[model samples]
Target: MVELPKRHKLEQSNRTREDEKLREFDEDIPDLRSLVIPWASMVIVAVIAAGIVLYNNHCDGEHSEDQLFFQSSDTMVEGSSYKESILERFLSAVTVEQHHVHKPVYEENHPSLFPLTTADRLGFSFVIIGLMVAAGGGIGGGGILVPIYILVMGFSPKHAIPLSNITVFGGAIANMILNVEKRHPLADRPLIDWDLILVMEPLTIAGALLGAFLNKLLPEVLLTIMLVILLSFTAYTSLKKAVKMYKAESRALREQGLKPDGTKESELTHINHQVEATDTNKAGDELLKDMDLQEGESPGTGDMESLAADKADELQKILDEERVTPMYNVSLLVGLFVFIISINMAKGGGAFPSPIGIKCGTYSFWMANGIMLGTIFLFCVYVRAYLVERFKAKERCGYKYVNGDIQWNSRATIVYPCICCLAGFFAGMFGVGGGIVKGPLMLAMEVHPAVASASSACMILFTSFTATTSFFVFGLLDPQYAPVCFGIGFIATYFGQIGLSILMKRSQRNSYIAFSIGGGVALSAVLMTIQSVLSLAEGEQHKSGGICGKDS
Candidate 1:
C-alpha cells in the first residue's frame, strides 16, 4: 500500500513537469490576438464608410458620368426625337454604353516607377506587410496591392492592375517553394493535394475567362457593390468558422485532462506508449504459441521467415504511400496552363494587344473562346473519370484516410469544382487574386488548414504566373520597380511561412491558420472598399468603350 502511494506521487510529479513544459511552449508563441483585433476593427470602419458613400451616390441623382453627359445634351432633341432621346437616356442609366473610344491618360501622365517621395515609401511599407499576410494565408494579395498602387503610389488603374499581378506572382513563387516539401499534419504524404488541384484549377481558369468577358459589360458601381457584398459575407463566415474550431480544440484538450492551451504531447504520448507496449506483448505471446504448435523440423525458422515477409510488405506499403506525386498529373496541369496562356495571348483585351488580332464580339474572338472552353471541358471530364476510378480502387483495398481528406465521390467531384469556378469568376471580375476567394472556400469545406494553405498556394502559382506573363508581354510592368517588389514579396513570404509554422506548433492550435486566412480576406475587403469609395467620392468617371473597340 505504501509502494502504491509512492508510485502515484511519482506520476503526479511527472505530470506537473509536463504541464510546465507546455506552458513554456505557449509563452513562446506571440499573441496573435493583438494583430487580429485591430484589423477587424478597420474592416468594420471601412464597411461603414462604404455604406455612406453608396447612400450619397444614390441620393445625389448623378449615379454615373454617362448619365450626366446625356442629361447635358437633352436640349439637342425636340418633338418626335425627344421621346427617342428619353429612351436612350433611360438605357444609358441602366446599362453602361460601350460605344466611345478614348485614349488612356496613363500614356501621357505615367508616374515614375521608383519615386523617392514620402507617399511612395509609405505605400511600399504597406505592400510589404500585405505580402506577408497574403503569403501566410496562401493568397495573392492583389486586392490589397491594386488599391495601394492607385491611391498612394499615383498609378492609374491600368498600370496598377499589372503591377499587382506581378507582385502577387512573386509572392506565389515564394509560397510554392516553402510548401512543396511540406508534409501533411496527420498523414505521411505531401501537404498539397494534387488531385484537388487537377480538378479545380482548369475549371477556375474557364470561369475566369467568362468573368473577364462580363467585366467589359458590367458597370463599375455595380461591380463594386457586388464585390463588397461577397467579401463581407466571406469574412463573416470565415471568422465564425475560426471561432468554432477554436472552441472544439479547447474542448478536446479539456477532455484529455489538460488546460485549454496545453500541448497534447505529454499525456497523449504517455498513453500511446502504454498502448503500443501492450500490443507488442500480445503479438509476441501469439507468435510463441504458434511456434510451439508448429510441426516443422526446424524450430522457430518458419515463424521467423513469416515475420520477415510481413515486415517487408509493410515497408513496401509505406514506401509507396510516401512516393512523390505522379508525373502524369504534373504534366497534365502544365499542359493545361500552357494551353490557357496561349489562348489568352491570342485573343487579348485591355493593354495586351492581341497577337492574332481577334477583336472582342467578333466571330474569331468567340471561336477562340469556344475552343478554350471545349478543351477545358474535355480535360475536366477525363480528370473526373480518373479520380472516380482511383477512389473506387482505394475503397476496394480498404485505404485509410487522414484528417481533412475530401472523399472525391461523384457528387463531390461535380459540386466542388462548380463552386471553385464561381470563386474564380469573382476573382477575374473584380481583378483580385484567385486565392483571396478560394482560401475561404476551402476552409468552409472543412479541409485541414495547413493542407488548404499549401494547395491554394499551388493554384495561385499557376494563375499569378499567367497574369504576370501577360502583363510582361504588354510592356505594362515597370522594369525598375518590378524586381524590387518581387524581392520584397519573396523575402516577406519566406519569413511569414516560418513564423506561422512556429506559431501553430507552439500554440498547439491549427485554428490560427484559419485566423490568418480570415484576416487576409478581411483586410482585402476593407482596402478594396476604401478604394472604391474614394473613387466614387472623387467623381471619377469610368471610361466608356465597346467590348470590341480597339485598345486605347
Candidate 2:
C-alpha cells in the first residue's frame, strides 16, 4: 500500500503463495490420535480376556507334556536300541522337529467368549498392538502372533500356527475392503496391483506348500535362528528407507520455502486455482525443454497448447490400459485355490483325515503334490507370458510411467516371482505371513509406499485365506476363539488403516508406512528369539523322523 519496491512486492507474493500451499496441505491432515487409543485398548482387552481362558486351561493340565512343548531328547534316546555318539546327541538336543500331524491337546481347548484372568495380560497387549501396527503396514503380523500365542497364550505350535493364519486372514479382509476402491496416488487405477497379485500369488502358495514340507524336516533351532536374522535384516532395511524418505521430504519442504512442520503465517482462500496454474506452467516448461527445439526458437502459445493436449490424450490412454479388470485375475486365483484345496483334502494333512484316505509318505500323497506343482508351474507360465506381452505393449505405446509401476519385462516377471517364492517359503517355514517379507521386498523394488501396502495386503488376503481354509479343514483352528481372534484382527486393522491414512496425509510423509513395517518386523525378531530361547531353556526336544516315516 505504501509504494513498495518491485523486488519487495515479488518476495511478499512468493511468501504468501508458500504459506497458502502449506495451509492447504495441513488442512487435509486430521488429528487421529483420539481414534487410536480407544480402538487399541479394545483390542488389548479382548486378547487379554482370551489369554486368561487359555492360561486357565493350561494350568488345568489340558496340554500333555509333548503338546506343551517339543518331546524331550533324553526320552527319545532312552528308547533307542543303539547308543548315540556325542555329536549325534548334541545334534539331537539342538535340533527342532515338527511333524505333519496335529493332535489337539483337548477336545474343547478354545477359550470362552469372555473369560477373565490376569495371566499374560501384558503379552496379550503386545500381540494386539503388533497386529494393529502390522495391519498398517499391510502385513499379517503372524511373526509376532505365533510366538505370542505359544509363549504367552499357552498354545502348542500346532494350534498357534493355524490361529495366526486365521487372524491374518481377518486382517487381510479388512485391508482389502479399504483398498479395493482406493485409487493410486499418481494414477487413476486402483491401488491394489491386480497384475502383481496374479503373477506372484500362485508361486507364493506353491512355495508355502514346499516350505511346510521342509518345516517338518528342518530343525527348529536352525529355523528360529534364520528367522531372527532375516527379520532383523528386513527391519533394518525398511527403517533405512524410511529415514531416507524423511530426509527427502524435508529437503522438498525447504526448497518450497515452507517449514517442515507445515506451519503457515497467513490465512488464504482460493489458492487451489493459483497452484494448479503454477503447476501446469511448470510442466509445460519442462515439456518444452525436453523437446530440444532450435536454440533461437521458443514454444509459441499454440504449439504449447497443442503439446499439452497431446500429453493429456497420451496420459488418458495409459490410465485406461493400466485400469485393472478383476474378472480374469479373480478367475485364475479361484481356480488355483480350488485345485490346491482339492489336493490337500484328498491327500489329508495332520489331524484332518484324507477324504480319499491318502496316507502320508505314500506314492499317492507324493503324486498329489506332484500334480499341484505341475498346475502351479503352468499357471505361472501363463501369467508370466501375459505380463511380458502387456509390458511390451506399454513400451511400444510410449507410456509415461509413475512411481511404483512395475516394468513387467520378461526378466522382471521371472525374477520377482522367484523372489516372492522364497519369501513365501520363509513365511511357511517360520509360520509367519508372506507379507512380512514381501512388504520389504516391494519397497526394495522401489514401489511407492501406498502401492506396496495396498498390493501386499491383497496378496496376504489370498495366501492367508488359503492357509486358514486348510487349517479349518485340518481341525487346527479353535472354533470358539477363532471367530473372536478374527473379529479383533478385523477391528484393529480397520482402525490401524484409518489412522495411518490420516497421519500420512497430515504429515505428507510416506515414510510412516515404512516405519510401521520395520517396527513390526523388529518386534517379531525379538519375540520369536525369546520364545525359542525359552523352549531351549526348558530342555524341549523335537522328534526328528525321516520324511517318509510315521508321524511322531
Candidate 3:
C-alpha cells in the first residue's frame, strides 16, 4: 500500500492493462465448441440418410410396374415360354375345331349342353343353394356350390383351378379381416414338422418334375389309365371310411346292450341308468382328491383307507393310460405314401413331366410342389416341439381347469401339424386346395366342424396366395386368360361363401347334414372323374384317328 516512484507506477499500470486484455479474450471463448462440431456432423449425417430414403422411395414410385414384371419373370426360366406357347396353341386349335363343329347346331337350335350361355345364372344358383344349405346346417356348402358351378358352367379343370384359387384368396382375406376384428391373434410364429418336410421337399419336387415330364412324353392312354386308377382308389377310400363308420356305430350299439332297432336315445338312456345305479362316486375322483391332499399329510393313511385309495389309484392309472394311447398314426409311412399319390393325381396330366423340344434338362413342377410339402412338414415338427415344451411348462405349473376346458396336451397339437402337412402336401401336389384334406384333418384334431371350416378357410387363403405367387412367377399365369378365370372364380367364390355359411348354421340342427354333404361331395368327385376320363379318351381318339374307329 506504500506509494512508489513514477517509473514503477507506469510499469504496474501497463501490466494491469495487458492482464485485462487477456481476461477479455478468455471470457469470449466457450466450451460448447467441442459439442457443436460433433452435433453438426451428426445432423449432416442424418440429413444425408433422410435424402437417401427419399430418393429410394421416389425411384420405387417411378418404376413399381417394372419391379413387378421383373419379379414375375424371375421364375420363368428358359423353357416355360416355349412349352406354354405350344400348350396354348393346342388348346386353341381344339377349341376352334370343337366350336366349328358345334356352331351350326347352336345357330339352328339352343342345345341344353351349351353350359357357357348360362354360366352367370348357374353361378347365382350356386350362391342361393349355398345360402339354403347354411340355413339348413350342412357341412361344406361353399365347396359343394363351386364344384356345381364348375360342372354346370362347363369350366375346364385349368380354368376351375385358377378361379377357385382367386375365390379362396378373396374369401380368406375377408375372413382374416373379421378374425382380426374379433381379436384373434394372427400367427406370426411358424408351426410345422421340419424333419419330414426336409426329406419330402426334394422327393416331392423330384416326383413333380418326373410326373410333369412323363405327362408330356407318355401316351394319352397310359395317362388316362393312371388317372382312372387313382380316382378309383380315392373313391374306394371314401366309401371304405363311410362303411367303417357305419359298422363302428353298429358295433358300439351292440356292445352297449341296445336292441337291433337302432336308437342313440335308447342306448344313451340305458348307459345313463346303468352309470347312475352303480356307485355314485367314481374311485378315480376320490383318489385324485386324495393325491392333491396327501403332499402335506402324514406318512400314510390307515389300512382300510389306504387299501381303498390304492384300488382307486390302480383303476385311475389304467384309465389314464387308455386316454394317453394313440389309436392311429396317420403321419406314418402308409399315410405319407397315400398323400404323395393323391398329390400326383391332383396336379393333373398337364403338370406331369414333358420334355419340350426347347430344353435339355428336366423341367420339374415338383421343385415348387416339393418345397411346399417339405415346408409344411418342417412346420409340423417345429410346432410339435413348441407344443411339447408348452405342455411341460403347464404340467410343471399344475394349471387347473374346469372339465372340457382342459388344455390340449402336447400330443394332440403335435398330431395336427403332422396330419396337416401330409394332407396339404397331397392336395398341393395335385394342384388342388386340399379342402378335403383340411376338413378331415381338422375334424381329426377334435375341432368342431364349424371351427374346422373357419380354420380351413384361413389355411386355403394362404395356400392360394402362395400357389398363385409361384405360378405367376413361373409365367404360368397367362394375362389374357387370367381375367376370365378370376372373374368367374370371384363370383363363384362369393356364392360358395354364402352357401358355406348357411350350411354351417344348419349343421347344429341336423346330425346327418355332414353325411349328406359327404354324399354330394362323393357324387361330384365321381362326375369329375368321368369327365376327365372322357376328355382323355377324346384326346387319345384324336391322336389315333386313322388307327381307331372314327365317327361317321
Name the weakest run of 10 consecutive residues (lDDT summed) in model 2. Answer: 28-37
CA lDDT, candidate 2, residue 533: 82
lDDT of each: 0.69, 0.67, 0.38
TM-score (all chains, Cα) for each model: 0.73, 0.73, 0.44
Writing each residue's lDDT as its tens digit, candidate 3 over 1-552 gives 121333244345435544543453344223222222332343344335434433443345432321122132243324445323443322221111111111111011223433546665665466444433322122223344445445665555544454445544554555444332221111111112122222323333333342333233224554344434433443344344435545665676578665434545645555645553332233345334433423343443354356445555555443343233122321442344445444544432232222221111213333434544674455446645654564444332222221111133444444334334344333432333455434433333333333334445444444456555444433444454345544443444455545544542332112232333344345435544565566665662232111111122
Q: Which pairs clash in the backbone of model 1?
A: none
Where model 2 places Cα greater than 4 Å from the true spot, the runs are: 1-113, 120-124, 264-318, 548-551
The residue-by-residue lDDT of candidate 2 on 1-552, one tens digit each, is 322343253345445544543453344223211222332343344335334433443355432322232333343444567644545433332222235564533354645546634434655676678888887789779888888888777877777878788888888999999998897766556888888888778887887777675455455566566667677877877778778888897786676666775443131112324543454344334433333333454444554456445654654565565576567778888888888877877777545557786755545766888899899999999999988887655433234455566777666677678767777766766667888878877777667888888888988887788778878866777776688778877888888889988877655667888888878888888888898888877867353232332335
Candidate 1 local lDDT, 368-397, one digit each (tens): 889999999999999999987765544332
Candidate 2, residue 536: Cα displacement in angstroms equals 2.1
- After superposition of all CA atoms, the RMSD between model 1 and the true structure is 13.2
* lDDT ranking of the models: 1, 2, 3
User: Number of clashing pairs, model 1?
Assistant: 0
